[model samples]
Target chain A: MTDKQRENLKNRIAVVAAWGVALIFFFPIFWMVLTSFKTEGQAIAVPPLLVFEPTLENYIEIQERTNYVKFAWNSVITSFGGTAVALLIAIPSAYAMAFNPTHRTKDILMWMLSTKMLPAVGVLMPIYFLAQKAGLFDTKLVLVIIYAMVNLPIVMLILFNYFREIPKEILEASRMDGTSTYNEIRQIVMPLAWGGIASTALLSIILCWNEAFWSIVLTTTEASTLTAFVASFQAPEGLFWAKVSAVSTLACAPIVIFGWLAQKQLVQGLTFGAVK
Target chain B: MNRTLVRLLQAPSIILLLLWMIVPLSMTLYFSTIRYNLLYPEREGFIGLENYRFFWTDAAFFPALMNTLVLVGSVLIITVVLGLAISVLIDRPFRGRGIVRVMLISPFFIMPTVSALVWKNMMMDPTTGLFAAMWNAMGWQPIEWLQDMPLFSIILMVSWQWTPFAILIFMTSLQSQDQEQKEAATLDGAGFWSQFYNLTLPHMARPISIVILIQMIFHLSIFAEIFVTTSGGPGVQSTNLTYLIYIQSQQAFDVGVASAGGVFAIILANIVAIFLIRAVGKTLTV
Candidate 1:
């Protein structure tokens, strides 16, 4: 066979292999969704009958057992609230670092990124103490603050990259036209970099939505996010696979749908400044 | 008013981040040096270096450290190698490429808690999980995954969630590969493997390092998966450093020991960060 035929055959094999791997990766999620509709017996069946009669009994039972709407509402409030607060802080910080970068700018950026590596357990005691002392424990405000701090680094990093992509010439031109720094940023910079900022916000919201460690530790029943809600499914009477799957499905649905809708933008934002 | 107002606008964020870092860290440092235990809430006082000494002497310390290294190292290697292969395969145009890409990347976005629970219940559960069902269908006994090999199970769950991230980075990097280099290599009779090794690998080095560094930082603090699935169980066999700290603080109520462990974790992470920054700086121009 010629080289061209060999290349074509190789490409075909590669594509087939890639598809197989993708399916394997996606199969667990498919199984979880499938199990959510199965009866308790069917969910834990020995042979795991693939052709079982699907039912919504698990969903109904989960709803009856737990306040699904309350948990969902808490998730929405905390995730969006955290994202808003983070953006409010990160925008100015990123703006300062991007446009008026001083000698300490890189260090500041690195410091913020390093904060992410600090294990939540490290500060669990102090934060927990502070929360209790201040009566902020299990409150939405506490979650909002913690989530903002947790996701601040990624937000700042992404926005800094976005702002850097907006040429310095544009900002300089706006300044030449007598636009104030605030006006230049609001009118010229933000409008030009709106796509990047929006995507960064979306990514931050997703991160905050998915954050489990602090949500589980810092909150109980009051302001628990979806992660805490799902974790509460762990009961003393052994594991409830069917009901847990139902809860898990509900918990992950919003972010998964958001991901599906904004996949292109999400991908772009995650890979921001990664390649170049 | 201009300079004062500018500083005023920035003060809240700067102060917040400063306090956020300093307060917890200083508390951890103070707690590390003292003989503090939450269970005996009133028995707190300075015992300089005692807590650190205890942590160093503890048998679980080295094992926890090694487990952390093993977890991070194994996941980084597995994800990068698999990710590169998958990314390269999907780099070329193919039918249903977009769907395949989405399917692969979707796992990364799944909440870590849900991912862990799904793996534990549906895929890794010995009796009724998919693996067990498959084994039963083949007339074989089911292998207990988390029960028998807890660390491996945790590693598997984490790798499943994070490999997608590596693939995303690799795919983005692959898109920027120079077609001219490949054409020239082909003209010079370079085979596919040779071209990939010589040209593609060199181009992908920076992204590979970035993925490894980022994964190391995150994976070192892996908590939710271990917490949700096993709770560092089967006698702390799967207990990485973070889990060990959690057990120390929450279960044992030994704040000093936990804080000491936290300091150790901080130092370890900083070491990794320093190496990563130096390595990436050597390769990355901007």
Candidate 2:
């Protein structure tokens, strides 16, 4: 083939290959969505029914069988609640790390990171006991606190990077040094770092929603998020596959939409700024 | 005013972390050395090293450790390799590239329980699963996934979730690849494979390492998938350290043994974190 002809051929092959991988990767989700529209019998039908009358029965049954709204509200409240608290705690420290730049800043940052490195299960028992002893077990407040603590390192790191990106000369020229730290952070740093702060919030919210171990262990009925509620199904018997699929779809739908909108931020935040 | 609006407002976080680093961990240390069980709170005493011994000698301990290694290692290899290929495939302009990219990355956002369940029920279930149908359509017996290869099943579940993460990172970095070098290599008769090896692969080195380290940190602690899919069963076939510890604490209520297991997890995670932080630190310092 001529060079131009060969290039066109290669392009065609790449398009086919990309679409193929994408569809295969995405098939489980599509199946879950499709299966949600089928009856339980049809869901587990041998030779897997390709075409069927889609039904809203599963969704309605799922809502009745489990308190779907309660679980969803828990997820929303905990994830957003946790992110807000994390930001509140992280902003000033990140501010110091970014602009103040003490000799010990690097060590402090590293030390903060090491705390995260301490696996959640390592401290699971003590935290569990403390929560119960303090009457915080199975409470949304308790989840909020734990999620904030777990996500603190990442939140601080992202905010610090964003804060650091604010031009130093602008800070000096604005005479923000004379202002109180809170006002300066409020007026100056917050506005300049809005994009980073937003993406950081998005990233943390997703993490909290997807968080499993802590949510499952720490909360039982009253405060359990969608993740914990969904874990209750755990392949019990052979029935409820349709209901399980429906619940899974509903639990993940909002976050999945949010995740798609935040893909660019996910790369930046998740890579810890390692990738450009 | 300046020094610590950062430090002052930061005190709660810093101090909480400091306390987190010191207090509860030291409590865990104390608990590890003592005999404490949530079941028998009244029976408490100093039992230095006994809990550690009991946990070490548990039947499932070693198998769980091995399962952890196999799962993390396989997932890391799969994600990096597939992530690189998929990213490169979609890197150049193509029809519906954005939509394809979105579809590929959607799994990462799925909660672990949801993905594991979806896979367990929809895809991997032997009789009723789609894989069963596919195999039967081809005139073969469907393999029981969770029963036959529990660890492999968990690996598949996790790899699906994470391959997207690696792709997102690798694909983003790939876009910034120096095109002039590719053109130069092309003019010198370098085909796609050679350019991929010499140029694209070399460019992806840092991202590959970053993906591995970061994925390792999370993979090492994988819990929910195993919890939902197999509960470390058909035996301890799929149990990893995290789930094993969960069983000890929550199931058995043996806090002391669980605490010892916790110490092991902490030490293991710290080893990985040193490399991860170093990688992150290098990027930051630059």
**Model 2 per-residue lDDT tens digits across residues B1-286:** 5453556866787898787678779878888989888789998899989999999999999999999999999999999999998998898887798899999999999999999889888899898889998999999989999999999988889999999999999988998999999999999999989999999999999999989988988998998998888999988889999999999999899999999999999999989999888888876641
lDDT of each: 0.82, 0.88
Off by over 4 Å in 2: A176-183, B4-6, B40-42
- Give per-residue lDDT, candidate 1, residue A159: 82
CAPRI tier of model 2? medium
Native-structure RMSD, model 1 = 2.3
Q: Report the error of model 2 at residue A77, Å.
A: 0.9
lDDT of 2 by residue, A1-276 (tens): 899998999899989989999999999999999999998888878788889999989899877877898999999999999999999889877877788787777777777876877888899889998999999999999999888988898888778778878888877866745765556668888888988889899999999999998899999899999999888888576559888889999999988998999888788788777776
Candidate 1 residues B1-286, lDDT tens each?
1546556655666788888989988989988999888788888789999999998888887878888888898898889989998998898899999899889988887888889889888888887789988888889989899899888998899999889888877887788899888999999999889999999999998788778877887888898898888887687688899888888887898989989888888887887777655543343212
Question: Candidates' DockQ values?
Answer: 0.55, 0.75
Evaluated with TM-score, which candidate comes out highest? 2
